[model samples]
Target chain A: MDQTILDTLHDVIVVGSGCTGAMAAQTLLESGMKVLMLDGGMMDSKYKSLIPDTSYTDFRQKADDQYKILIGENLEGLNWGEVSTGAQLTPPRKFITDQVEIFLPLESNNFHPMESLALGGLGGAWGLGSCIYSPPELEKAGLNANKMHEAYRVVSDRIGISASNDDASPYTSGGFNYFLPELEIDSNAKSLYDKYKKKRNDLNRDGFFMGKPALALLTEDKGERKKCSYNDMDFYSDKDKSAYRPWITIEEMKTKYKNSFIYLGEKLVKEFSEENNFTTVTCIDMMDNSVKTYSCIKLVLASGVLGTARIVMRSVKSENVKFPILTNPYCYIPCIQPGMLGKSADQRRSDFAQLSLFHDPDKTNADVAMASIYSYHSLMLFRIIREAPLNFKDGRKMMRWLLPAMTIMGIHLPQQASEGKYLKMMKDENSPTGDKLFAEYSLNEEEKLSRKIREKKFLHAMRKLNCFAIKKIDPGFGSSIHYAGTLPFNDNEAEFTLNPSGRLNKFKNIFVADGSGFKYLPAKGLTFSLMANAHNVAKTVIEDARK
Target chain B: MNFAEENKYNSEAQILSNYLVGTQVDKKSLELYSGISKTTNHSMNESDLKIWNFLMKHPGFISSIDGALAFTNPKSSVRKKIFFMFAILECRPELSAKFMSSNFTGFYWVKFIWYGVHAVFTTIFGLFLLQWIKRF
Candidate 1:
């Protein structure tokens, strides 16, 4: 732990162990580079065994007891009801890091962006909705399509995606390889697919496209992870390693290249500085209140969009900078198939979003909207019932009876940067949590119009599938949980932009490997592309080191 | 009381009994009921008398049924009170059948059968598949 040994031991220092950071660290380790990864979160070893595997009825009986044991009494009052429907609820591990430190403007109150300081970052709570950027989408994001394909193949081979090239291929821009068989769709999803297949020609003419969504879930057992047991506990429990989490990669690095990789938990990196040929990183040890500095040949900041932006702004000693922040406008619409009402029990495995419906309404514009179909039982029915028009008591009774009949169609609309949408860094010198970050985002007139059009088109498609009683709930901004574009990459190295290789223009040794370096936030989920970009950046760092 | 008056009371009692069994009392209704009860000094109104009589007759079913409903309606005072009602009569199979028939459908029974068969096959075959993959 001495300074001399630390300086001699590690070549690259990576902040965060989420999807991007872990992939970067693994790639670097494989290329004979020693890495020191610092994370503010600690992994809970007893999580899997501690979670009970009982029937839902029995589980509900012990709900209070389980909550007390799992999340503790300290977080009993946390408003979980506020986040009704999203990818996943904040896990118990995020209790410490889920603090609301940002100051939101009046206009941005609905914009709630969740960040996780868990060992795997937000990837721990991710719905595993993995989609590769189409060639056009990649070009829009200012990335080389050929290089991205190479990176995508590398990522797909490691993560193992469950997908098949189908009708939605044109939208996904299919060419990349898939490693696992597509998951079997549930009866409800099968009904929708059958209808879509029957009316394929008509639907295609109406600009509607449907296919199985690419998911980062394993169909067969791989490594230490087991295949999905279809136990329907994906959102709350991690008992089955069938779903790919970033921790798996971190664990692989630790086991395979133990000598080359070292993970230091409970260390939150605040800022970094470049001196001569080495970068000095200052981090606070959360366990004890001590500040420590680590020096490395190169620094990679994959602490996520907001986390990385805070560190960069603090390093530059800036109070407020107009940085463009992008997010996909998200909404979930419920469609009821009355025939399927009160039919299926909630015990069966309801995978996240079995079918993805893609729509490109206009050929002139690159804008696209995607809707993923989810079974009713996949999410907590209590949350969905609250959105019902009935009173609380009546709603509960009705929801219980109608639970098996509902299907949620989640729509993600592509959002582009405008003059009003930007993040401002607050100057808080005395606080130990670093500077507070505030964002102000408003959709342009055109984007607002586009959203209305997309909703109408989606409802039409739902009606075509014999779904009735359609209700849409737009969760508003930041609910997408797909945030990017803080320190965007520019080929021209524009003011306050990262270079094409993810290295900052001013700092020679610093590299950003997360969504912060994205030039555009596409409608699809960002994790798959984030991992691919991280791999590309790691390769660039290795090649640069050789030079 | 006259025979006509007695017939009217019985008819009202029948309607209230159906309401107690079918409808879940929401928080707002419970609050209104509480206010009315306070103003009337807990004197049994026709509606209240019928509800109380129903609870007394189905004492064994009242607590469990009310308890489940009250848990889902935590904020309702009437539901909370009814949940702890004392039991005297044994729960009847006929009453249970009525509840099930009212709440469920033919589709539910068919789907449950399908799921049961599917679950059994997956459990057995999944284990075999894992073992075969491990051997490879």
Candidate 2:
């Protein structure tokens, strides 16, 4: 970074380049407030070009020097240990968690989270599911519902969402505008959806609503982006820019608001201090391993929930302070769709969530659980066959026969603040980040029993759709990556709390623009709400600055 | 790997792929597959080596050995090597379309039923042949 730029007082400083931080910077720059974004912004230098800009099926057919893309130089994902949550993440997506433990270290006996310092952070590898939080859900999260709904419209328009007004809209889509047509799904999803339609009334009465969920995928060509080609490579690469990533918005803001928007990549933000009505943000530039400081009138911490908690606790000069950590407990059940049995895999399709099933007992918002269903294939049969209870050759043939009828139902349960589940920042001299976050997360018997009961109900519902659940694969704790509830916005002037307007209660000029302010982590996807809250927080900062 | 280790891995991966895909794998493919597994620390144990030696002499015993161990322990070293070989072969386009086939034909059940019958017959035959070969 330039010394002169650091010496000059920036109008606003945004801490991350993730989904929330990008929206915050965009809102601030659109309002003509000069903004500076400091991010790690690490990108994949090796496999991005090795991957051809063709459909996943085409790549499999052509095999254009594909040794590096699937299996990395060091065999990045093929491991002998227990399977991690994102083990299916292709080699090209390694940058998402490339140096996360080094830059943002965390220690937990049970919880294993996936944090990203990549160019677009975790949003770079998002599944493109966009579940809008309802008004009641927003209220539980201590956010203004009307303002959030309006911001949802703004962000929805900015990133063209693809969805249809179907039965699942009441639970998935929160009445957002400007959506493209739904993308085409595969044979398994179509079979399950047709089965659900036949048993719609009974299923609805049993509290299961299944339909096409909202996705951040382009159905048709948009500005500088093309429509989804049904390549089934959403897990690997975004060749046609069909899926909306946070970096796309950041790139747009860089060109559109060149004078107002300034992004400094390869810089990880550390703790900040408020002095003389200006916040001095300290960062470690990864390029030269040098400590740099920049002063800003207003600072927005959108560096994820745990990232924000690390800075806040460290800034307060507390070596140890526990903050509540909430994450949607996740499990993936590979169900067998009987209707699609003995049917060939679709030639052209998407691997993203083809159908979303919401388990809302009252059909309202309270105590709801969501399941995003995906069709199998394109991730390769080896990952699935490895778990089969047959011989390798028999397992291979069995998976080849079963892949066409498989539907992976990834269910996420709503989480709340529990005493045993909290994250604390402690000093670590050995770590490069200067501090390490220790998270203690475990489910109590009551919580576990309730989740099992709900999951059993979901299994029953799946049976109604003619999908048989063989067994459940617990990917592990905090793997959903929808971490939240740390430093939630409250009225009191607590050290680890924020005001309703996103201003830090203990500090005057600092604010949070991420899930750190969320009081309740709803079962729905939180990316759309995170972006909306960041936009609303930026607008609130502008409003407060005028005062 | 040295010359011995490299040759051993190539020959083993070849036999595994031959059994899984019903075809032989090239040297380059074998080299790449074994190169990736070097970091995995999945080399065979004593019993796994015992089974490996038996399969080396009687390649048809792979089905029986793996099928018997499938229910008891699927993560055996020999089983893992077979999976590793299958994974490398799946990367190729030679038989991927066939591997991805659902057998969506009028006689789909016939092939599926025949596969089940072959599985039972091979397992019974291998159980006797392996132990009988070990005695000799």
Candidate 3:
């Protein structure tokens, strides 16, 4: 196992091929460093080959292994031992908040959950509702807004967004558009907007309704992509229109920087060491069980929260390496009516289907994203209906009861707070496996208040819009599916906090630009923030690496 | 009405309709048993047609029929309520054979004995097979 037998050392190695990894790879390569990326996802999306067929039948085909993870049909049969590329790989059981006890302080259980481990990361499954973190929220998160905003512009320029400039309605005003033209608003959407506009205008919250939320979709027919053809299908999967998947950006980077290499289908970095100012990463080739080492002048830990946490806690151990992770508290709001027969008649059912509500943070300085609430289509609706933990075998019973249901996702503030807390590994003689994931969490007081406020806002908005029979429920941790915080920054002077040139401090010639670096946000999806921060960090790495 | 003119009219209105309800169906789409033509009209035996007409037109007479033949016994791979009549038909022909046999003539008297025993069993067991007997 001599190091000389391994592949040639690259300038950097990136883990996790989701948003953060893809953005970091593109930026680093653009800055003239040979970059190597490793992801736990498959080599390509299931439907990547058939550009013309817009059906999701490919995902259901035997070739796709459709039940590979959460999106697959064989979820119940897969072993939990196979689930974790992250820190805590718990077995699937009933959704219980207080069952397993850990050393961390116990608290309320509230969280926002969203996760996917596909080639494009969550972008593959995201509703493509692209929005940047509001200025105030970024400032609260101790990030440079101007720099982050520039990064978002670069991302939008590369990925092509579509949005309308109209600001006359409550649900549509003041939002930025993508690179593409606005989607033709369907007839149902026009009617609903007209019906609700007068009421929305009277409420006077500066809120407006628009055709489709700004999306990172393609505008032209290029490379397995087609122009938006008014298909009205976004959530489950679209065959004709190409929603932005990060693999496309990564591919573009490969053509621009031929020297850079990105390897998919590899997992688990086996070892890392520094000698002669060069940090070497030896990762396990998960497919063949072979180990290979990669070297670079600088390394970027751009794997996301759960990913960064798993890698760090597995590699680094000590009482003092503790960092606070952030959890998003999320909820679903359903607006039902007595006469509603579960038919797809409303404009919201087909158009952009976006909804917006205001959020005030639960805690001071808590990083929160602008939590937008919108309806879920069939795929998501099926999952929500199946969430009752009812026996799946009772098909007839489910058919009778599961209809007439709709859901809207509400992101709570104190975006970083959660009832589930994290714990560091402790030394023990009787330990069978290595250091275990220790977490004890519950919703904090402020997060609960944020949920309450969102409930009130949804109720009020429903009444104003004449959307009747609205009811609210509390969604617990792990449901939001946005997990982070194993490696986080507390203040500006953390030794491990900033690498070098204002990156993670302790690791010279190393940078951490992923979601694991953030303490938390009150409300917002972290895509824009992740890209912007990666750009700023890559700039510092490129500037200082030469020196 | 010659053959060519008659064929041309059939081609224009080739939809298959339900024999009783007249629900129109695409002839090509319906999954039928082997040898069943997609374009052919729905058919039942003359005996079955008589039974079906009687049942539909006079619903009250159905409860009064003591031992009537079943109509339109469509055989399906899917196990359903139609199997009860099929099972009775498969089993009923055995009864007359037992009555005609020399040794089974004594079993005719055994039927009386068995009836007395079933009556006692029903009195004790609360007539558990009453629905089956009523169907028979």
Candidate 4:
């Protein structure tokens, strides 16, 4: 058959069904462009049909393949000789454990890595804790807080977040006013707030009060999405409320833009055309191994941190690329006090409720940069301990008694290091997972110290909160789930960046909106930030095209 | 109704299954079938004992010699596993209902089922015991 060519190539093709991708697709389609979205994984209709009364778990009985954990599992020792060498080339199906070998080398070998492979990517399974990047994070990206806030307002409005705060400024101006009725703080949490609020005031530090952060969950009726019934379970299966998963927006985007199309369970993109002004994408469908091709005037790669980085390294065979890379290292601390934790898996409190710890550069010493602290739900805490195979046998017993365990994630922005810190693409023969992932990364002396110092601080905080037990992680026991930066956007680097509009500098049609274009170090979970960045990039692409 | 009360009112078939599970009446048979001398790890928890006792005292007693022999067979792993799990239900049916009916009921029930299945699948004799239990 002659190569098929249509009169209208899509204005843009958004790759990956992650939050960033969905946001880009929604924004672009709403702007009157022909958009096509291609998810590298399957579709999740559980939350998709929430308001419409469709249940995601109508028939699910156990934690089967679909409910697998959201992390990569190299399983080197577990899968030796059972599978062929090529199997390691792809991501694992189960939520990855720390035992799996990572592609990146460590500085002193410290980092806890976790990433997912489902259609919505990490956002699908992430603790639905939505905190807009503090002002410092915006400045790190070379953008002011106002611009970032504008983009967040746009995103928050579409997703229908339910939140309230005494101090939400200019960012929440547009979208903040309207949302589901403010979630009522439970009496116990309220009492804890009163107890801590006075003590926090005494410390004179910005004491965070217990209130629901503006979440993309519905409390009022919306199309096909029922308002939340206060069932505070945030992670895993959200059988009730429609929280901020990308698939929800994608459904709306698909309806608004009739020209838009989506393909799920499709194979990963194997090749793409970025030669002239147009880009052609080619892939081998995993379902049947059949080759499929998609062409668009512009292509956006949003396959997330590791996935996007790997794709770029494989697709662009050119060695002449200019951009600095940063790897984020994380630490977890659990705080438990008698009676602080109530029943197990009860729907008494929201899991994603906590304030983020961001580094105030102005207040910090010159040597150290700012950092962001995040909280995890009890269920996630249980999963983290369960991942350690050593305690797998007694996980149930531990679950019975352990009170509030708080996980503090400290994102250490890796400084530039030539020795092994820079993320480089490498193909290896003997990866334990039987596949070859782009391997490159090593922490520097500063990062190594940063890891220890932050872990210690978090540990001390836990102790102050009356925690009984504490455990520090050693090197090789860590890996970051949120991977960002291998492709930094600099106006000067034509060969590396997509120029001013987030397009590949050389290829006018190819663009990237995910974490790939970010250069900020110690990046907080950049999902919302990247969505804003995509909004700006999409606006630029359309405006420039008109010119 | 409570598992005990429910077991009393339950049909003879379900009662026998519950009693067999609650008392672990087939412990000797399971020990013989597995051929492994184990004490603590393989032994039934308190919950399992409750289920076995319920099964033995169930409304429909296994009166026939054949039925009795089948129930006592040590080789039936699936049947044994099911009875063992049912035994747990008998012990703490009230707590189980409480867990399942709570606000986050869906998540807890899902977790309860998952842990239960994981334990059952790990045992070598579980599948056979389940088959036997289902047959009766």
Which candidate number has the best TM-score?
2
List model 1 lDDT by residue over A40-149, tens digit each.
66565444555677533345444434432222323222232344334345244443244324211112454567776778887887778888887778877867789888
Candidate 1, fnat value? 0.03
lDDT of 2 by residue, A18-59 (tens): 999999999998888999999988888887777777777778
How high is each candidate's interface RMSD, in Å? Answer: 14.1, 2.1, 25.6, 14.3
- Model 1, global lDDT: 0.67
Error of 1 at A83 (Å): 4.3
* Candidate 1 stretches greater than 4 Å from native: A2-9, A44-47, A53-110, A172-175, A362-365, B1-103, B106-136
TM-score between candidate 1 and the true structure: 0.78
Worst 10 residues of 4 chain B by lDDT: B31-40
Query: All models, DockQ values?
Result: 0.04, 0.55, 0.01, 0.03
Candidate 2 DockQ, CA atoms? 0.55
In terms of docking quality, how is candidate 2 classified? Answer: medium
Q: Which candidate model has the greater DockQ, 1 or 3?
A: 1
Per-model TM against the reference: 0.78, 0.96, 0.63, 0.65
Candidates by lDDT, descending order: 2, 1, 4, 3
Better of 3 and 4 by TM-score: 4
**Model 4, residue A403: C-alpha shift (Å):** 3.4
Error of 4 at A436 (Å): 3.9
Residue range A1-547, candidate 4, lDDT tens digits: 1143233466777777778888887777777777766665654433333222222222122222211221111111121111121221212222222212342222222333444445666666554545566565555554446766788778767776666654231222223564555555443344334444445443224322222345566667767776765544344345554667776666666566655554444456655777576777776555565677777877888776655655566577655332344555544443444434434423445545433333322332122222233333323222343222221222332334332333333333333323453444444555321233434455667767876665555444334434433444332322435555566666775555545457666666677777666556433445666777777777766775677
